[model samples]
Target: MAATRIWSIKGRLDSVINYVTNPEKTDGGKYTDTELQALADVIDYAEDEAKTHNKVYVSGINLSPNIARDQMVMTKLQFGKTDKILAYHGYQSFLPGEVTPDQAHEIGVELARRLWGDRFQILVTTHLDKEHLHNHFCLNSVSFVDGKKFRGGSKAYWQMRAESDKICAEYGLSVIKNPGKGKNYAEWKAEHENRPTVRNQIKDELDEIIKCSYTYEQFWKILKQRGYAVKRDVKYVVLKPAFSQRYIRLKSLGKNYSEEAIRQRIIAARNGIRDLDKPKSDYNAWLNKYEPTKLHGFKALYFHYLYLFGKIRKKETPQRVSFYMRDELIKFERYQKQFRFLYDNEIETVEQLTIFKENVENKIDEMIIRRSKLYDKTDSKTEIKTINAELRELRKNLRTCNNIFIDAERIREHTEYVARLEKEANEPQKQQIKDYVIG
Candidate 1:
């Protein structure tokens, strides 16, 4: 599960940008050499000390050439330097629900302190006045206290958020809710899937066919029924659906399900023989489908792979895969108590969650079995008991899931940025580039 625990901060960009551009803006309102020195010092310190995964450069200042120069003119940042050393955006994030801005800012400072304790060269700026919610994190990019290289990429960014959440929780602040997968790429993918897409429609149809058809003709007939055009030839069949005109053959499915088998499955399905082949494997059945237990199993597999690859250092495995903890179990019951308020009215939210949790529990049992298999032969009851206890703890945490912040703007912003940049490349950028390069 990718991390999505984002810590977002916003500050006066005008002030900060000005300060960065012109050293004169450093003092109070007017920038000064001292302020510039401070920001540079912070960056240097953070880079040296913060144990970072990657250095990420993100910014929201859309640098229109005309306006860009004006901004720089105000800031006095190498006014005539045309060649951009770097094109980047400055941004901050944590998971969907973690700590708020105040807490997140503090966490940034804490990270600096942890990496370079007592060496203060960190500044958190908010860009609230503008039409965006963003933050400027100017640190030394190194710490004097330690020599951990500051990494600022996606993974490091989330690690920062996770540490923030853990610390915030420790400090008694209202920690934002997170499902361990942190609101990273995977969550964005999930959200994107909810939107209308030709690809999604294709997947949906493919899934239906997977469950219903056992052979090529059966598959073809079903597709035709669902408004596809199919032509059978002597050697092979060509399918021209409303969505595409791709030619598919028996070889496409797999080696075992050859042309002969593909046709056979279709025939069997057409004949209404339910058991076309032996039986679908557990994995094949769950492919392109969503099931809580299966999902939990997948999460288990993912972490196992990550651990094996040494992506993250091994800690006592998290008790809850769905981001639940023992402390919040009772609170969850209360939160959902409203649904039970009309138990007889019989809504199904609680029922669904109950089923999901049960499925998760079953997978945990499965996990134990798998663990036993993977490790050296030790079927000791004590070992099993310990695993079960951890499973229980995991169950308690996942029994109630929380993500306090319900809104997201980053994806939309990224989407717009991509579209606009693509458009610029398509239209106005061509002649400008030709002139700039040739002239």
Candidate 2:
């Protein structure tokens, strides 16, 4: 199956252009030396799935791929549509082992042609750096034909999906029969990381309110009093929490949170029947179910960080997360990478991480000197290429090590901040205890 996503690029158009065509970084995330070497060892990378040794194939529709960025910029300038969005970057990713790199590129080119080939300028690149073959399209927001901006929204995405499905069907490829609604990157990332969002918070609130509500009307009243604006519809009930700008449909929450489900839950509560559908509320139950492993070094720090950020024990009932803590969710992915780097290298402490980084740097410097000498040779091309590849991996590792130091320090600071907040929150209870003891 081919999955697709498109997002707008606001700043520099060349950044995205250089990324897709450039060989250094294909997919996001820092790669280990092993992966880099594996990519480098493949000396005969095909140019297309069709006929060349170029592992990646890049094509420009209505423009040259070489200067696609400049052309896109010139079009934007001609139309005076350069103020907001510069370009649109979209990707069509195929399932691994399903399609060859050439076939994937052909499909990508066809899809782009059917969608935007006539009106807008597009740069289609098929990147084979990863196991799954995917195509990246850098589309100019401003159309070259009419100088009109490509109106991008849900409609555009659906249209792209429909065309992609049609093309994939023609190619005898599997398509998503029932694709879920596309969420923005931030929301999707937050959900993936198990960080609490407005939707989750609202679900948690409903879980609590449903227990005490004996009637459907009582439920709506309780929800409104709890700062949720209720909009009853013939088919679906929608709710807007005080903190959320958009109204969320009840059905969107889950099958359990649907209007009929809510009414059934109320009836069950009225009959003194405990809800089997209720959230797993007992922390002890979670502890008994899964034995906690003792973590140390960066791994332990990451666990603690996730815990304090309200992402550690997600199986239990959701808690009302502080608005301030939501911002830290973005760092969860970075911290995960740092943890993996430390664990994979077997570096336990900050000092160990420092030493490891130094070792990588020393190796890099030595390789650079060797590479320089090999460059002077007329017959050392193979050895020089291998050395250059190894050097790039070393430099990438060095950069990752530097980032680990900064991230480790941030984790420490956040840990200390959480401790202070807990202490402040307990001050009143401590004062009450002292008064009782004195009395």
Candidate 3:
């Protein structure tokens, strides 16, 4: 069982972090040297996990552990130097039905007052429904009850852990063993935390279910029953199983059985891959011979880059509000590029789209001039050039974003369009291109 042990003492916020991490201190907290040392050791043990010689690494530092690991930041503002340290020593201990830590602490502290005459102001509360059961206790070094300072957690620390464990046993909760000391904190962390990732841990469970099916047909049915998707082809099969909303491809289930091989087997066992394949015989043969689906997906990457502005935030702590704005702009860019590409690609086939697009740009220019004519006198030439360039550049990107079968013939067509455009970018056509490049 794991735990969440949190403890701290306080003074100046800067001083506390400096002393704990970089240990040495600078100013006044009104506490004497003896009081300071006692508090420092408690912090030392809590932070070092009680090991002067051992190093341990624990994580779940929200916003990154480096910033969130030390919890005192929030509390320091509540109470500062000259104010008595008021910390809530809490933990998610692996004990069930045990008395709350505060109750236990209250009983112990109260008894100490009766026996040793050490009185202090103490506050304790338990929090449930979390990863573990724990409590928070706020007590001053000196008794607010009787104004007496009490020594805490040095030699008396192990006594607390042991006492808590013994108390748990009496209440039918399991007693936890302290693996540290007997084994220092750092060494214990090294011993644990070597566990596997969730994905790897599920591998065995997946194999157990999947291994039962011998052939692709059997596997396909079982997979479908379990909500997995099967894609069929003449060569092999593709199985996509989703786990926790993320999909995984069981590309190679067995040795010598590639996804394509399985897909084809599964399809042949049922019908064939022809149903999903494109018609047009020669092109079909070309795809089967040279352009596989794997080859086609790479062309999609080119399309992905067409509208990319490459705007990066690049900040230490990114202002989260801007992420969605950036994403929306990217999506709008994609929409514009795709619309233009379809409009241009249809120029020869539909002819109407080309005329419609020209009219739309003409209207946009008319509207801009009519609206801004008041500010004119200036050669709005620069502004006109800028907007036209924006239009042309957007169109150019659309041509690049096409995700289609890169059949050698289709590939040749794109190659020619690119070559002609590149050649046209020279001297004579440069002015026409520049007309559109102004933006």
Candidate 4:
């Protein structure tokens, strides 16, 4: 099957022309790369053609092609008075070993003509450098006859794919029955390489965050705190995680992780309702098995101590949990990590944890102050490098401290909220009513 992908080329007309007509790919001016053996009449190469008298033509309207970077610029100037788009580029690739280079080229030319022959001026080139034979089409965005611009959208892409599939089937080539979902070229390449894609990483992070968050706002806040830059688009949310250069569309993740679905998940979780889409966790089971005697302050601390000393037996654990913590044993292992962090730091009390957090903050502040002084005093690249190295170490240390501090604070808040709920539950109905009204 021949897969098709297309996207608009937005920028200066000259640059686009140069890229499509690169001399190296054109066989050093022999033009063997092209399918039709010659560029279309509408595309002019007068200076390069010498005998053409330095004239460019777009369907009988002659102009200087060389002086203005060839027919692309002329076309842009002619139709650009009404439209903003410059050109469109598309790729049609045949599966490896399915078709010969010559066959692929012929099919590509036919496909291009079928798609944009009447309106746009197109150049089709078959590239043989890759394992899979492919055709590249550089089509003018504006119409030659009426100056109408090509309006591309989701419908246009679907139509293009349908045409391609029909053409491939005509040549006795296999066609993809269900193309399924679309992915950009980079994502496709990364998946083929078995690397974790940005979308997958973001989805994993979102799943973890949703488990801890009680509301939409809290979910957003948690993502931001974890170094993601969230942007609200018209129909979907976009996220640019730390160290990433591009923003990922949430809708592109999948139907299950859409913005509306995530919002519904948050609402359901807040109302104590479980969603089938969400994975079940053993947290409630763990709580029930290890119910606290006192439903007041220090419950979190007491549990941490029990967890740290291996007092919570594995036999008492739940059978199933979320995928990340797949079973009771795995969940206990995760708790052990947190328990060790607290125990190794000697953070047995909330007061001690608070002091430890303050010390870390002060250390971070001291490093920042030192770095600022270094920046002011040094202009040498070597000195700057040394300063940056030191700063990076400090930042790493600070991240560890931040994670511990957040966990400790969460424990404190959760324990206090549970204590308040228990206190209310224990009071008489009339006293509870009076308490609710008092303040």
Top candidate (lDDT)? 2
Question: Which regions of candidate 3 are displaced past 4 Å?
Answer: 1-6, 11-81, 84-88, 95-118, 178-439
Q: Which one wins by TM-score: 1 or 3?
A: 1
Evaluate candidate 4 by giving its C-alpha RMSD to the native, one decimal.
22.4
Off by over 4 Å in 1: 1-90, 93-120, 129-132, 146-208, 214-439
The superposed Cα distance between candidate 4 and the true structure at residue 35, in angstroms, equals 17
TM-score list, all predictions? 0.27, 0.43, 0.22, 0.33
Better of 2 and 4 by lDDT: 2
Ranking by TM-score: 2, 4, 1, 3
Between candidates 1 and 2, the TM-score winner: 2
Q: How many pairs of residues collide in model 4?
A: 0
Model 4 misplaced regions, further than 4 Å: 26-69, 80-83, 180-439
Of 1 and 4, which scores higher on lDDT? Answer: 4
What C-alpha lDDT values do all the predictions have?
0.37, 0.70, 0.37, 0.57
lDDT of 3 by residue, 1-439 (tens): 2233434465443442332222121111245655544443311111211123221111111111233223333333333323555432433345454443323333333222232333433333333333344433333344333343445555345555555554443332444546533322322333353221223222332443444555656766765775566567535445544432333334433442454555454555455223343332221121233222332222333232221212211111122222222323223323433434543444322244445455655554554444335323346645644654454343333223322222223434543444454455454667778888895
- By TM-score, who's the top model here? 2
**In angstroms, how far off is 221's CA in candidate 4?**
51
- Cα lDDT tens digits, model 1, 1-439, are 1122222223333443443333322111333445444443322111211233222111111122113324433332333322322111233444443433333333444543453234323343333222222244443333223422234457756565555555544433334436443233322333463322223334335445745876655666677776666566646544544644344443433443455665665566568665544432231221224232433322322222222212111212221211112122212223332222223222234355456556655666565555444333445535644664565445433433221111012223433443454455456567888889998
lDDT, candidate 2, 1-439, per-residue tens: 7899888989888899888766543423344655544433222222212233434366677786666778988988897788888889999999899877656776887789889988999988778777888899999999999899888888889888878877776554666544465244345546775655566667766877898897999999988887778888556677887777677778888889988888998898889988466464332332233222756777677666655544423432122334334445545555655666766787768888889988987786677566656644569868965875675467558767888778778778877776676677677889999999999
Q: Candidate 3, which ten residues in sequence have the lowest lDDT sum? A: 55-64
